[model samples]
Target: MKTRSGKGNRVGLAVLGLVLLAVGGLAIARALGSFGDAAAREPVVDAGARSFAATTPWFWPVVAAVGIVIGLIGLAWLLALLRVDRPRRLRLESGTTGVTEVDAHPASEALAEQVSTYPEVRRAHAVLRGPSDDPHLDIGVSAEEPADLGALVTRLHDEAVPDLRTTLGLRRLPAMVRLNLTGGRRTRPVH
Candidate 1:
């Protein structure tokens, strides 16, 4: 979801931020007598605005409607963030013999555990995405700060990824690995 809507979210946030900054800057300018002391003391809506609002009965209703629409849009965006499209079960085999269905979550978890056991690894995670037939794997690994990143990455490409593909009976399993370095410091004996 973030991948798809990332650009839109960024643009929207940028526009909203700019608008807010302009409003806040105006308020601060008024407070500092950049506009006037009277402007600072007066309500946000001036006499002309207030008179127009009073004369036009639809003004308050329009404002209320706009607020509701914005609120609903924000609620939708938040709900979209919570939505997951991950495939729960993966079809390992669907041959002339029979169908073999495997729970993707457990399989991915086991893979993560396997990777976590590697030397210098602190923690790991794995997620399976896309359709049941053809799945995509996303792996995250956190290693000690002093870990040999080159060796770990090489192992992932040479050993772990191929092993997973072989286990899942996949010709090619597209895997993305995200590596992080843990902030933990190994204790040293003070001389």
Candidate 2:
């Protein structure tokens, strides 16, 4: 069974994209007179619904309430997307100090820059995930060439991780490294 990690966001965004594309295409088609001149003359909400909304005293208020509810839902969704898994300024586990904190984004950015300068590495990006006590280091490294992948990963784990741990004042930090080997023009093999 496949685990669902960020799949919902992917699927939701994909469906929203398709819907938005369709709506845009329809609007463009209408603008180009694909639906003929009669479409522009048509009532947007139809005559029957318009008449009911006009006659009923509570219709407009109900519609307004529903619109507000939808607006609130949309706002909540936006907030959730912006929310992070952990705090931006992480508190360090100081042995004999009153308080100590580190900004996660800056620390990750520094680590990424350091890794990118490593031998056989083309580029790197790092993100700190999870809580401060048990944080996960997600590093994406692009290798200069395929042959250097093994040595690059080994060097990254042995040297870079420990160095980051020391900087963060942590004893252990679990890292998840994603390595991508940069490929050039491929030579055709004769069978």
Candidate 3:
């Protein structure tokens, strides 16, 4: 199964990072006297504290409400992290004329096994995506040394893909195949 992109998560993380960086940099700069001398800053702190002391009683309630809203946002973010998307299932017909449902995981495993049997491939994995009735495949293969990649691609296009489509009763079996070299070179003993 394929997972949806987490663009929202990325944006949230980026904004949080920038806010932390700005606030931390400001605090460090103030502590390091980048703003001015320490003696000159004493009056500014005293004036700010005096202004805060003059606030009306309603100010505290507004601050508490803002804190609650921030807490709710945190709760929502946590929920999103925990959420899982269910995989779609493939429907098949049994010899008894009954209908059967197969999960994507098992179907993908079968496909991976079929593809891995090729002499050039060291290992293979497949993932099914989209609805079960109309699915797409993402296949990854590890090739042995001296494997002919071009011939393999041709075989997939001509034989493997058509066989998969026919077996699955699908009109088209859209697939993405990735190949990687599996390093297995043995060192020889020197004289």
Candidate 4:
């Protein structure tokens, strides 16, 4: 994969270099021709004017050469950006048919199930915070009501902690349930 990408970039750079060189050469050629024509007329004209026309050819070639060099430098910079490696998370796959399974499913699933039992909880998402060495979880709980923030935290702690301990065998549950009050519930009309 790396080699293929590198080769592609090289090919692109080569094409760009060729194009720039061609343009530069064309520019220089045109300038030189113009200068030559002016110089040929200079002998019939004045000495000062002849010198000025002679210097014109040198100016255009220098400008064209600088443009080509700048284009090459820009191409190199773009290639460097393309070649940089991006960081990615490692995913685990099942062996038989190569299906991907999420890491620490049991714990997260159990937590979600338990949190959903509360009447006030509208929606909940359990996410593992860290890697294996020292792991934690951030359980984001969207609530139906704004009341009882303290009570909700205590209730979740009381219910989830013991259940996680028994079912998932998590000795130290570094699980934090953050309650986000979405809005108040709609009131039903009296019949």
TM-score of 1: 0.67
lDDT of 1 by residue, 92-158 (tens): 8898999998898988888899999999999999998888898888999999888899999999889
The digit string of per-residue lDDT tens for model 2 on 14-104 reads 9989999999998777766789887756655789998999999999999999999989987987887777675487678556657788898
Q: Could you give me the TM-score of model 2 versus the true structure?
A: 0.63
Please name the candidate that would achieve the greatest lDDT relative to the true structure.
Answer: 1
Q: Each candidate's TM vs. the true structure?
A: 0.67, 0.63, 0.67, 0.43
| Model 3 lDDT tens row, 2-61 | 233477777878999999999998877777788887743655457666677567677678
> Can you list the residue pairs that collide in candidate 2?
none
Pairs with steric clashes in candidate 4:
none
- List ranges where model 1 is wrong by over 4 Å: 1-4, 36-43, 46-52, 55-61, 82-85, 91-101, 119-122, 130-134, 143-151, 180-191
**Which of the predicted structures, 1 or 4, would earn the higher TM-score when compared with the native?**
1
Cα lDDT computed for each candidate against the true fold? 0.89, 0.82, 0.77, 0.68
Worst 10 residues of 2 by lDDT: 1-10
Off by over 4 Å in 3: 1-8, 38-88, 91-100, 185-191
Better of 1 and 3 by lDDT: 1
lDDT of 4 by residue, 1-191 (tens): 65787798789879989999998886676556755766544444478767776778786688789999999998887887665342122134336777453446566667887787777788777765555423566788888766677777887778766675445444565777677888776789999
